[model samples]
Target: MAILATGQPNLEAGQSQSLHYDDFPPLNSCSKLKIGTPRLPIVPSLPNERECKIGLLRNRHVLIGLELQEDFINVMAKNIYYLLAKDGYLYTMKPLIYDAKFKVEEETTLTMAWISFPDLKPTFFVKESIFSLATAVGKPIHLDMATINKTRPSCARVKFQVDLLANFPKFMEMETVNEDTKETKIERVKIHYDRLPRYCLHCKVQGHAEEECRSIHPELHQYVARD
Candidate 1:
């Protein structure tokens, strides 16, 4: 008697469709499989549009926040670069204006004195005299001038005077000579008090201090020593 198993295909049909053992021994079931070349990962480009939008938003905010006067803002903003390049300081406030008389008085108090030169041509002689006098006393002298009249006039005379009392005794010295003696013998002389030895203040005393003055300050009696 013959017996048949269930769900099994006929052996002759299976052999006709499958690999033949004699032909290449049928590829091994556990052989390594090779895949095609792998594809590289893709990297998206940066979003330039988003960056531009952000920049635009920031600029708008700055413009909106700058609530300044139209003209002033325009001047400052438009000229800022040029002004910064040219000037050291950013802003310049208004300057204070005062009368010329006040200014002149202030200057005079700090200055020696103002010399008047009526004649412009003779100014050379005046300048020479000032230079000589200043040099003789070893003091610095500065010359300055101003116009008296705007229009033309007749004969012009240069009247120049120095502030001999500017530096007080420092720039001047006074000396007195005694000519009472018959033979013109050396007698006692009086030297003036001065901050410096100039033509304004000088002492010419034999045995006394030149700073002693009875008219200026009587309390300075201690400075006078009688022999």
Candidate 2:
């Protein structure tokens, strides 16, 4: 049902070349579709390869004949596990079914899932919880602090704030107390400035006031001198 574009001339465009599914034999199984046929050596019969391909296509809702690497297939299974693991029923049910049905290599798939945790931010809570449970049950986990920090702010915030406070209460001032004390005595004081002399004001000096000035005002000086 899927059409793959081969980037060749179309017969409808009068180039006398067209390629379609009809032109080629139906691949009886996905194993028959090999990668790098002549350039690289052909892959020997990959056990469960067809089931893997079918499972990927079905679970991911992707078209068949989409070229996929082994690593990509592994990653896809892990991602699916991460996405579905939070759903209680799906977590318990689907992985077992998926594992049994697809025959996914557990160590490889779980490792792939763990590595993929950083990329799947939306499912970080579920992934982290699952990881914690696994670690509690004595499963070895390679914790990526940077990846977890990058993905989950809530977890990071709780780690930096609450856990740190719990571990180092003195440093965080968690139990410190503040007390208020009473004061008994009070006093008041007045402030004063030294008085200035009068005549020095007419000469524009700092020690004098204006009222008793010896230097005449300009209008007064003019009238007095005229007199």
lDDT of 2 by residue, 48-166 (tens): 35433332223222212323333233322321222121122222112211222232221111111222222122333332332332221122233345544455433211111011011
TM-score of each: 0.15, 0.15
Task: Give candidate 1 regions above 4 Å deviation.
Answer: 1-125, 136-142, 146-167, 170-227
Candidate 2: lDDT over CA atoms?
0.24
The C-alpha RMSD of each candidate to the native structure, in angstroms, is: 52.0, 39.2
The per-model lDDT (C-alpha) reads 0.22, 0.24
User: Roughly what TM-score does model 1 have, to 2 decimal places?
Assistant: 0.15
Candidate 2 residue runs with Cα over 4 Å from true position: 1-133, 137-147, 155-227
Model 1, global lDDT: 0.22
